[model samples]
Target chain A: MTYCVGMMLEKGLVFMSDTRTNAGLDNISTFQKMKIWEQPGQGVITLMSAGNLATTQAVVSILDERTKAHDERDPSILAVPSMFQAARLIAKTLKDVIANHAQVGQRADSAFNATLILGGQIAGGPPRLFLIYPEGNFIEAGADTPFFQIGEMMYGRPILVRAYEPGLSFEEAMRLLLVSFDSTIKANLTVGLPLDFHFYETDSLEQGKTGRISADDPYFLAISQGWGEALKSALDQQPTFEF
Target chain B: MTYCVGMMLEKGLVFMSDTRTNAGLDNISTFQKMKIWEQPGQGVITLMSAGNLATTQAVVSILDERTKAHDERDPSILAVPSMFQAARLIAKTLKDVIANHAQVGQRADSAFNATLILGGQIAGGPPRLFLIYPEGNFIEAGADTPFFQIGEMMYGRPILVRAYEPGLSFEEAMRLLLVSFDSTIKANLTVGLPLDFHFYETDSLEQGKTGRISADDPYFLAISQGWGEALKSALDQQPTFEF
Candidate 1:
């Protein structure tokens, strides 16, 4: 299992993803689930995935291969004219990978299903965020829904609901995303650090800050520990219930 | 869908449950999911259930009827010798009710499955808590695992993990529970207000305070609004992420 989130802010798009993957409780490994394709000053595409690793990796690899082989039949995600077209390409690629796995006689079709969060900006278009489904359908984030989270989402959702604001700067949004990821990591063993994150500043037409936060990252540790104490104090400040 | 939680504290036991029930998203209703069977000065057994409404209602009805009919062949849950036996009785009743439903040709076995959290104290036994599964088996909560949650549990769980203390007063416990329920209610339309809760003090041998909190309940309203502000500040107070 994995936990990943993509947020649309007034400034731009923010994305974060955990690195943990497990075949079973005993078979655990780390795999970066955040993929970025950039054409500086022209466009940038960031994708965060959650679900079957094979399908997600296949989708990314195929998109990457298309960028290298321009003569290939498929268009590169980086070459897409708009974020909408990029989302469609990724959704189609994800659908094709899962369908191909099913054709190989996988016993369960759901075993190969994957969901992705696609966000970035093209030169002539505004920054956009989308949640692409395994079925090749997608939905964009808007004012009513400013963020998209995939995999192991529930534990970390309440804070996002309460704290997310459209005007948040990139740094504040990063703090918010880390706190969400921290809550998820504490509640579920399947989602752990190091976490991968990418920021896309609106209209930059290029990738912004990006980094990997390991288990020992001080900023993450501070947020993880600080959030717990802060919650206690928060509850303390609330009016006491009367029996 | 429903959200229910039972916790063991130093002073007593605490239980809270939501009131929403739905057959489909379009078909919604409110039904109490918490039931208490008390023999004042003898014992108190409280059960909170989640899953198929039919199965839970049947299990409660059987237990209630058995208590009313003294001459029934099977021993009443009220007549059980200890908290352990009461838990076993309830589990068996739950399993039987589900089996009966399946025997009636229910297409999906899970359609009639239900889970319950049983907590209270019988005369000779100390306060006890057990999570009864659909298979008629159960696991008791001990010092290491002081709480149990059932159905739509993930959203409300992190706060419980972080803020729960064994020595909390019933009033404080109620505050904690409301915060948890508030989070769940905000995130899931299927789990709504008009929440129900009961408290059982150790050695009391009877139910303690009980109440239902409606959507307009002032205290709930305060906590619901206050928590959002508190969380925002909590994130604000955390060390800034240096991008």
Candidate 2:
């Protein structure tokens, strides 16, 4: 039960992912779901995954291994020519990992499935965001749909749909994500703290800024409590229904 | 798809259901999902359903037919002794309907499945609310969980969880439900107008106030717009994160 969201705003890109993972209620653990690949002036790519941990980890391991390979023939995420190509590489790696595990005769519906949010900037192109499916296919965010959310998405979606604006500054975007994530964590136990966040400026072609938000973080606490109180106040302000 | 929510508050019980029904994106229609049975001075029972429209309609039809029968020996929801018994009657009828449909070799997971939120009051007892599953089993809403939602629930759930209070006035409870439904309608295509709302006052031993809210209703519009604006304003007020 992960909740990861990525936005392709007019200014740049914003990505956030929760760290809690669980096979069952009793076997809960924390695991990082965000991976970053940067080439400074060349480009920066951020991948946030949700679903089976084993499958996602395997896909990341394969990509990392290729990036470190001495042979120039080996394809790597860093070697991709564009954001689109980087999405394709991650999608392909994910599909291959799932297929390899399925070869052991596991059912097609086996839990070896994972979905990813890939967003970043390439040197010559605008920042782009994509939602990669388990089947190795992906869809890019467009003007009509400026964001993509995977895993435990519904609880936090209304807020995003109502408030998201194309020209929002990176600070405002991160604040929006925090409110969204706060709603999710309060409603669902499977999604919890130690959240990973990354912001990529359009032409910076670098990692931009990144950080982790834990449960005790003052800013996170302020947002959670503030949002709740604000909602109650809002409800009080609304006109009552007449019968 | 449907979205129906029922809450048990110290003042009484609140029930709301959207009227939209759809087979797919191309085939959509409006169908009532709330049914009420009242023997003034005796009891009042409200049933809100979600899932296979056919199955739910059949369950209601069967219960209605039995209650109209002139024979005294025939079992009927009207004859149930307590709210618990009423819940059992609805559950049993629901299970029988699903089983009859399955005998024709339809898959168990067929769209014949339905879920319901049943709540009301009978003479000499406090109000009660139950969530009835397709299998005919049901669970009552307790102190810890005073509400039940079926079909497309997640989007509207967080607000209900955070703002619900056992002692809220009937007006406050209805207002809370409107906000919750407003969120659901904005986020989901399957749940829409007009909404059916019913309030059952404790020990009233009769159906309380009931009304229908259509898409253009002034009150509904106000809540829908007010909630969106309030949420955006709240987002603006939150402290931004530092990276």
Interface root mean square deviation per prediction = 0.6, 1.2
TM-score of each: 0.98, 0.97
Candidate 2 RMSD computed on C-alpha atoms after optimal superposition onto the true structure: 1.5
Candidate 1 regions exceeding 4 Å error are none
lDDT of each: 0.93, 0.91
lDDT of 2: 0.91
Residues A20-40 of candidate 2: C-alpha lDDT, one tens digit per residue: 999999999999999998999
- Chain A TM-scores, candidates in order: 0.98, 0.97
DockQ of each: 0.92, 0.79
lDDT of 2 at B66: 84
lDDT of 1 by residue, A138-168 (tens): 9999999999999999999999999999999
